[model samples]
Target chain A: MSALVTGATGFLGRRLVRLLREDGLQVTCLVRPSSDIEPLRQAVGDALWSGVDVRTVELMDENGCREALLGCSVVYHLAAGLSGSTSTLFLNSVIPTRRLMAASVSAGVQRFVLVSSLGVYGTQTLPPGTVLDERSPVDPHPHLRDPYTFSKVVQERVAWDAYKASGLPLVVVRPGVIIGPGRGVLSSRVGLRLGPLMVRMGGGQQLPYTYVDNCAAAVRQAGLAERAEGQVFNVVDDDLPTAKELLRLCRKAGAGVKSAWVPRPLVQPLAGAYEWYHHWSRGQLPGVITRYRTAAMWKPLQYVNDKAKAGLPWRPEVPFDEAFRRSLTIAPAIG
Target chain B: MTTSPSDMIRVALVGCGQIADAHLQEIRKIPSAETVAVCDVHQDFADQAAARFEVPRAFDDMQRMLSEASPDVVHLTTPAHTHCRLATELLQAGVHVYVEKPFTVDVREAEAVLEAAHAEDRSVCLGHDQLFDPSWVQCRAMVQAGAVGDVTHVESVLGYPFSGQFGRQVATDRNHWVRKLPGGLFQNTISHPLYRITEFLTDDRPALHANWFAGSADVSIPTELVAHFRGEQVTGNLLFSTRIEPQRITRVYGTHGALEVDLDAQLVRRSRQNRLPGAFEKLEMPLRHCREATGNLCRNVWRFLKSDIHYFAGMRCLFEEFYASVRSGSPPPIPYEGMLRVTRLMEAMFEQCREREEAGDTAPRHSQERIKVESDHTIKSDQRSNQRPVTTNRDESRELQEAWS
Candidate 1:
């Protein structure tokens, strides 16, 4: 099989590209013109570089993307704008993805796997302790969330819209925070780093973490699996640690952290108060904490990857402790 | 001097860019303003915009649009470099002009445009719509009402995202129009923070010192600016940063209190002196914050229900005021003096930046110096030859379990 991967230079993208190559597939890496591919070359090493084809094409350039996708049967699109203003995020991420979807349909690709984020779920509105699975609805009002999450929600919407309209083979893999070497272990899921102080929202909430290699494998499986078409999979590793346990592990690993814990019950009210203050003060302090965002981040919920495990027939190869150890061996932060 | 309510103001738009859509959308909301024509150098864009907005006419040539459409008012949403000539031509053709921000390339061009408007007896408005945001309007009203006492200082900080479409275009494309401007990337946006400062500073020529440098390694053109202006009694600072979290806020400090306006969020907040004594003040502050926040939440909910909340609410308000001015033959929404002052300030800052660029002194110095200082300090402080290595790499999972035990 020949596969094309966008964002093949990113942390997770590099891993996915390598894994796809290892599975005896001819891999074509679609990178932006300005993207630095040296890191990708280093990650793939000198030996495996023979089978990998690198194509410099902007996703917004429909003709270029169509040309790049000419021989590729499967496409793994992982490129997205992580942060920006709403319009910026929409233009950079959503609009390009829409164009790519159009180009993919035109190219007659077999399968198009979209790597989305678990943050797209409308979990805050759900009752606490609800099992957040593939069936969970995405954010209804994405504009109320941060620009990054808002863009992702819209990107998924457009992907589904394409799927419904053109019968494009689509599979969405919503991965949790991917942690590995070079990338830090900390994420907003654990706590927000507000300057020197970390505001750890709640302790009992499970940190839905998928090690980068494990996430890449699941994404590969999603593209290859026949059952994954027209399905959404939540890619999360088993034996996840709670936010407190993760913080404790970090502290034990000689990473000094100063944290203030907010109890689970008080999290929502505190966020409301914080949102109120942030808005009332005309953003005197950064509007990092808002009621909607806090609810989305800290709400106590259970994550299930049963659909992914069953449909993709995949299991996380790396144990949580082993993954944590490998992550800490190179970097202190894991996210 | 005024048109009847039944009479509509025929409006044409030039440069069918991203902002042209905003102008057209807001114009459509007002029954008094009729979008008669849309024009762009790119004829396809003009046609697309006209079709999308249901405008009657689309033309690639400005002269043809003006002559054929006969629009009473023309919105100049073209590039800043083209703004001066376009505004001048539009005014000479007996039409009022509304130019987008960074009104012109420099004060000279701004003067020429204003001169043309004066000669034609037509009103001209710059797109300084942030000042017209409901939050900012309320903040200004509070300041005028002495709620914030006498203004002493103003700090305007704008956080731009280099990953944004405009930023990417400017950074990647060397020949992009924004790169050709006097201030390069900063010229396109520095006007926002500058005008916010001038609203309170009210000084045409303030003692100014500006530092411009690229905070990120992506582009060479300056993306970060820290400008200080001392306006006789009040001191103002403008921070335009592309590397930070995106925000648009202006803070005004006064004798008794301070007020901040978050134009993006459309919220206004103030800080007053705490009268409580001792550690109780610390507890009092959060409670007060909650109270103020709750109040804003209630008000915002009301506004949202009333459909008064939107990304382009400020632009809509500005359009209404500008259109009203045009109909009544009154002065434009923004005073000519204020526009001139903002343009002059921008010219001064850009001049300093250009000088620094020519001197080859625009690169950020602190990071390089800090790296050197840290390396030297590390070399000087290494005196642990006899010390044993710290055993900090124990199995954290086991340690975490034991801590619970």
Candidate 2:
């Protein structure tokens, strides 16, 4: 069977392409015309490569997207802009997925795998005991204006809508903080050096992380396993380490840096003031406040990957320490 | 070796620079040693230091200081380029030598110093006191004891925001050494921590294979140098830079657990037993259990030394080891061979840079000479000179051969 992969140059997309190739499927990659081809060629051998912009329906209209997806038995939509920004989420996640789903339907693709995020829960101020699962309602706050999260929520909704309308056998995978080797923004930007020690919004007790390899394995499983059709799985690891635990783990994994903790109460106000100052001085809103608020990442985001385990026969082979080590090895090029 | 406090070993302080003060301060704390004389190329620096330290003699020439002062030990604190020749001269004259970090600019020079010491049946100790620091000692002990299990890898990073101290020195003609020095910050500062790490981790020395990249700006100094090394069992990476604003840290990854040291804080973390209120808890904890451990340790060490004599007496203990080894024909604590190995590694890094330049690679961002006065005064001084290369005469060649052999 043939499979078409979008965003094959991206961190997750690259991993999915490798898995699909290993499974001996005739793989086709739909890439932007300007995307770097070296990383794609390295991940998946030179295969059928088509250039088309996911955002422009003109490309879809010209049947370029459809042509790529035509012979593919399954389509994996794993490309999403993950800059941790609101606008990027809308442009990359929401709009692109909508376009890709419509094109997949037009091409009569049998199965579609929609890569979603745990951020869609949008519990910015979740209480301590909240455990987010697939059953959790979409309760995004009015002020919860992260474009990426909004897009993921909307994209997942669109996938469900497509599933309802045409019976397009769709599987949605919601992954937590995906970390692994090769390329990750976390390792490149914040992970390489110690800036300021911080706790999540409430003492850094919240947040769950999934190893990148594990997330990829889950996506691979969702794409191939028959039972995963029309189902959503929260793909994460068993261990639920808090932000402080993550810091300790990084140090253990040879980050070779010490962090000084800033009290949670002090962070919010200080971050607000810095944001205000940056905004007033520059006459433009600075994203620093949002970055800092994300830094205060406390909201216990625990998940059970039991559905993936039971239905897809997938298991996370990488232990936490090894995954953490791989996360540090990629030092992102930071200016 | 059995000498007592009253039978003090006479020592000469060479290269009366900033670090010389620290060495002298440490020496004064040693009751078994006395700084009998101070020597420097600059007469004023030597004279002023001798007067301040209350030493009896001062000399502009090191040869004069060695003969006149008859020092049992010579503390070599000169710049990297001059360390070998000066230390060799002192060793040949029957004086034990303690040279500072990156004992020489090149492996050839280091080997010459070792050969001279071996010919004279004396010992040379490179001044890498970080290995002897109490915090490092404790951390090494824990690793040796298998407290953290078998170490698989180690990452060492030493950095500080460019304070412009060395740059300012280079900018002024005061010390052109910083400008001419190879590998810049890595060779000058990071060598200490890197050497200390190698010493701590290995029973047998490891072979270091390194790839280097210059930071993206020409500030007349290097912003970063990264080296990856491996032993039979362990592989490690050393990142040295002056561009990073954060404090220094070193981490060792092991099978069972891990150990991290915050050099700026002088703090260590390892798994240990902790007594909580209700239950006996086995927990991981940082040393000293306080935030400012490094500052606290420094203050405590000062408080322990009630007077200059007390402090100097303690330093003399370290000095006497070099002195007694020279006198009794024993090996120094930090052997000359180990010093040569580190020097060679440093040379290899420079060779990489030259190779890159010859290949027409983009010039490294930081101008090694920019921060120095000499570089500013003489533009493009590093450009290859077309003047006839000075061919070494047979006599000088023979002298070098004799020194190494």
Candidate 3:
């Protein structure tokens, strides 16, 4: 079987490409013109690579997207803009996904897999006695006004809407903050900076997390399994601990950092003051306090991934603590 | 019977250990107070202290001492495990109570004392004296003023071998307070410096996540203790031990620079370029208000008596606040809410320790039964054969790193 994958150079996308290739499928990776191919090469070792922009490629007019989709029986769309201006989310995620779905339909691709985010469930401070599952309502807080989450939500909605209207086989995978060996934002920025001194946000009880390899495995399972069609899975592992426990894991993994909880009330004013200063100074303000306070990364958001497990036959390969430790050694290829 | 200002604060010394001497000396220095009575679990010890300090009253029973002396404040210098029970009973009897560190072995008991204090409308204070240290207070003020731009991290270590003088009672008891405390050194000793350090850095209280291993529990000493504490904008590690030989250090890393304190030497080091001329020199000088007096007591005593004074002052402050609240309808400074938060943290540490032990990763090293030899000839042969030569320094260092890695 032939498969076409977008974002094949990305952390998750690269992993997916390898898994599909290992499964004996002819994988064609759609890469950006500018993405460094070294890591992807390291990951997939000379898989058939295609360089093209999905939106600009006159896929329908010149049949470029359709051509890529032609021989491929399955289409895996994983690429999405993580951050930019608010409007960029709509343009980058929603539009491109719609275009890809349309192109897949025209090319008669048998199955479609779309990678979404647990962020689409939005910023959840899961109440005591309740755990979030796929059926839980998405938070309406406008995705933290973050382009990454906004784009993800739009992307999922587009895939869902298109699948409903066109009766196409679609599987949407929403993975909690993806963490793995040298992948994901937390591993890249947060893990590297962790050490003996780390200020834990608010008693570090709130849960905000993901593991990369586990999420990738879930995505791969969804792509291959017929049971995953028409399903949306929240991919997370068990033994999810409070933020404080996560920090302890980081410390054990040699991050050796301290975690302190800052009271919200004290930091809230500092955030407001930072925003005001930024506005008054025309964005000259450093916004350190404001950035720390506004970023609700420490808040609890528990997700249940039983649906993914039950349907996709997926299980997390690495435990959370082991994955966290491995994340420290994952050096990103800096361009 | 209204008393003059000179006799207003009558004090009783409870648990006459090494710390009680410091408290008695401080009381001698305070003009309005006198140590009317001394109590110890051992009658001889109480008699010795009463005679040495020229006190009129001494008792083995705490209740007898409290009733006869009618002390306005009771200085609790007992082991941490007993602080809650004694403090609760004393507070309920309308005596302002001061308890030593660890405040209580458990939070629930600490809460019970606070509840009792509330019911009786009396004052209670924990002996966390590092909070009042001038250097710490100064450091706190600077961080609050943005001296080290947005204090992000703090590291504290209060590590040392078990004191040479910890005594036979502690040595013999397997489940003694020192050996069995939730976090061992992290609680019994490091908590003093940790609480003080956090109090200085942020107004926000921290949630603690600790991973501890039994470093030398086999040697009948507590192991290397490490804890990570997180606040909203700050994170810190508290590393402590009763095995590592005499080391006291604390470092606070901020965005711009770092501030470190060496408690043993009483030195404060700042990483920033321009510093005050006498800042380091001033730290070398002994602490001045040792016994609540206005003048320099550091020179007279060569040691600060207020270490105990500071310890007892917490109780005094707790009592003064409680008395004011009862008389004028106000709240105490060391409020129950604050104590509750501290208790929760204490409970978490205990839970983490129990969890680690249950996982079998932190089993006591000394729990293994020693093999008995049939005779001296057999014992000598076994000792000689079993003695593996110690690795040279270079190989030892490499092996240590590899083990940790």
Model 3 misplacement above 4 A:
A1-335, B1-3, B167-175, B180-186, B200-207, B273-335, B362-405
Per-residue lDDT over B1-405 for candidate 2, one digit per residue giving the tens place of the 0 to 100 score = 555655677888888776676677667655567889999875545754575467899899988888888988888888777888888888999988888776888877888888898898777888766665545666789889997788888888877555554433343322356557776556677676677556645534466555445455445444566777777887778886656865667888788777777655555776434545433332223433454456556654563443211212323455656666755667787765567666766687667755665675524433333223333332343335522222255554444334334
The lDDT, on a scale of 0 to 1, for candidate 1 is 0.84
DockQ of each candidate relative to the true complex: 0.04, 0.01, 0.00
The collision pairs in model 1 are: A184-A333, A184-A334, A184-A335, A185-A333, A185-A334, A185-A335, A186-A334
- What is the descending TM-score order? 1, 2, 3
Model 1 lDDT, residue B30, Cα: 75
> What TM-score would chain B receive for each of the candidates shown?
0.89, 0.74, 0.71
- Candidate with better DockQ, 1 vs 3: 1
Q: lDDT, candidate 2, residue B231?
A: 78
Poorly placed runs, candidate 2 (over 4 Å): A1-335, B1-6, B171-175, B200-218, B271-317, B324-329, B360-405
Candidate 1 structure quality by residue, lDDT tens digits, B64-162: 999999998899998899999999999999999999998999889999999999999999999998888888889989999998788999999999987
What is the lDDT for B399 in model 1? 40
Indicate the residue-level lDDT of B256 in model 1: 92
Order the candidates by lDDT, highest first — what do you get? 1, 2, 3
In terms of lDDT, the best-performing candidate is 1
For candidate 3, write residues A1-335 as lDDT tens digits: 87888887798887787787778887777654445667776776654333221222421132567766777888888877665433333434665677778888887788899988776763444553356678876645543334466557656766878888997799888877776665522321122133544554544343435576677778888878876689888887877766556666655656545445556454456567767865444333332344432543434445576787788988887876676666776635210
